[model samples]
Target: SDIFGEIFGGGRGGRSTVFRGADLRYNLEISLEQAAHGFDTKLRIPAMATCESCKGSGARPGTAPTTCPSCRGAGQVRVSQGPFSIAQTCPRCHGSGSIIPHPCAQCAGSGRIKLQKTLSVKIPSGVDEGDRVRLSGEGEPGVNGGPPGDLYVQVHIKPHPVFTRDHDDLHCEMPVSITSAALGGEIAIPTLDGSAKIRVPAETQSGKTFRLKGKGIKGVRSQAPGDLFCHVVVETPVNLTERQRQILREFDAISQQDSARHNPRAKGWFDKVKEFFES
Candidate 1:
């Protein structure tokens, strides 16, 4: 039976004659910070492993398998009807050329069992969404002494609260009060590392973008750090007190007295509208 099993290129009911292990994939979700900076994490996955009790032989203790007699250890049998001969796998041994008389109780003659495995994965810096980390030989157990498949860990970055990423650059909106826009001042802005001060120029209008060099994320393939763009948005005062409202009204009256100097953009826009209407 041993010689016949060797001749048939099949193990003695220990391994599969034809099938290889299947690869596995797992999705790992991480924060934007973790994606920007490398992180180490552990994953618990359910997978197939070789049965310890059977030792991947599919036979009970102290027992051995015998070659199939149905196909004379050939793994396949021939059927003839009139003019043609059809070759088919022997149903008794399922083309393994061997049969396990006493099956292992743990794996139920499958030579493998489902188990939970723990694997540590390292996520590199600047890994974006859909990037995969391959762990070699960490997948399902192979059959017929073949090599195990690989495990792929897919990355998914969570949405950031303040910044939006574009390649290596970061963009965010900074809200400035009306007073800060009117009178130049320094305001603290958030960055990846920490907060930085940005100068708000006098009479700075809304939608003005300011770039901070080397304040963005550094990619894995990038030579230098990217910049951070801060778009200034002038916020209108809300919930104003009666005294503040009166003061604003007085200021508005004064501002209207010198509209060309105080509000040149508004005056120019009005002039353009007046010209268009007259023409």
Candidate 2:
């Protein structure tokens, strides 16, 4: 019947339509250090795979599918109503062009089975948040001999304990002793590689920023590595002993005598207040 209708171009092609498979997405989370340095990982994905019971033929043992006798291997059938003919899917074969009389017990005549598949993925260095790593032909199987779709791995970076990332740069707060802020010292700071010493000049004030070159992450597109910014936070001495309190009182008395020279910023601030009130 299909051969007779095709000779007049009134029936569909004998084969089913080819369609690409659907794409898939997987969320991948990694540490900041891993994001800085590339790593390879394996993923266990569960999806539809070709049945091994009947070699994806959906047939029972020693049996095979046969062409639909109603549609004559054509997925579509034409119905005639007096003078007009309407083409529709073959109800007998369900547009498969063939009928599986003895269905496979494993796949249940679907020609596919749910199974777990292992896939390898490579995560490049310096991959930021929301970056996608695509793997070709790693998605679901195609339909009717069509091409398979792709799988996308979305990257997410875990929060760092000490440092906060800003594009390629890194920022961190470094607590300094009040004496070190008043005097000079060489202190150790944390970097992505390890620890490094930074010289704190005399009279280093709070909120002062110290930049260390090439101490931050080298991004994927960056030719050179970024810098690390250290914010200084002067911590005041607490739980002072009686001797220390007495020494501080003596130091304060001396500093007050030369307040204009020792604390020029404080002197300037009070001068501004005095002028504002006088005006």
Q: Write candidate 2's Cα lDDT for 86-183 as tens digits.
A: 66788998887889999999999877789888999999988888889999988877776778788999999999898899988999999999999999
Please report, in order, the local distance difference test score of every candidate based on alpha carbons: 0.86, 0.87
> Who wins the TM-score comparison?
1
Give the local distance difference test score of model 1. 0.86
After superposition, the stretches of candidate 2 with alpha carbons farther than 4 Å from their true spots are 1-11, 66-73, 77-95, 267-279
Model 1 has how many clashing residue pairs? 0
Q: What would the per-residue lDDT of candidate 1 be over residues 96-205, giving only the tens digit for each residue? A: 77889999989998889999989999999988888899999998888766778899999988899999999889999999999999997999999978899998999899
List TM-score per model, in order: 0.86, 0.81
Where model 1 places Cα greater than 4 Å from the true spot, the runs are 1-19, 270-279
| Cα RMSD of predicted structure 1 | 4.7
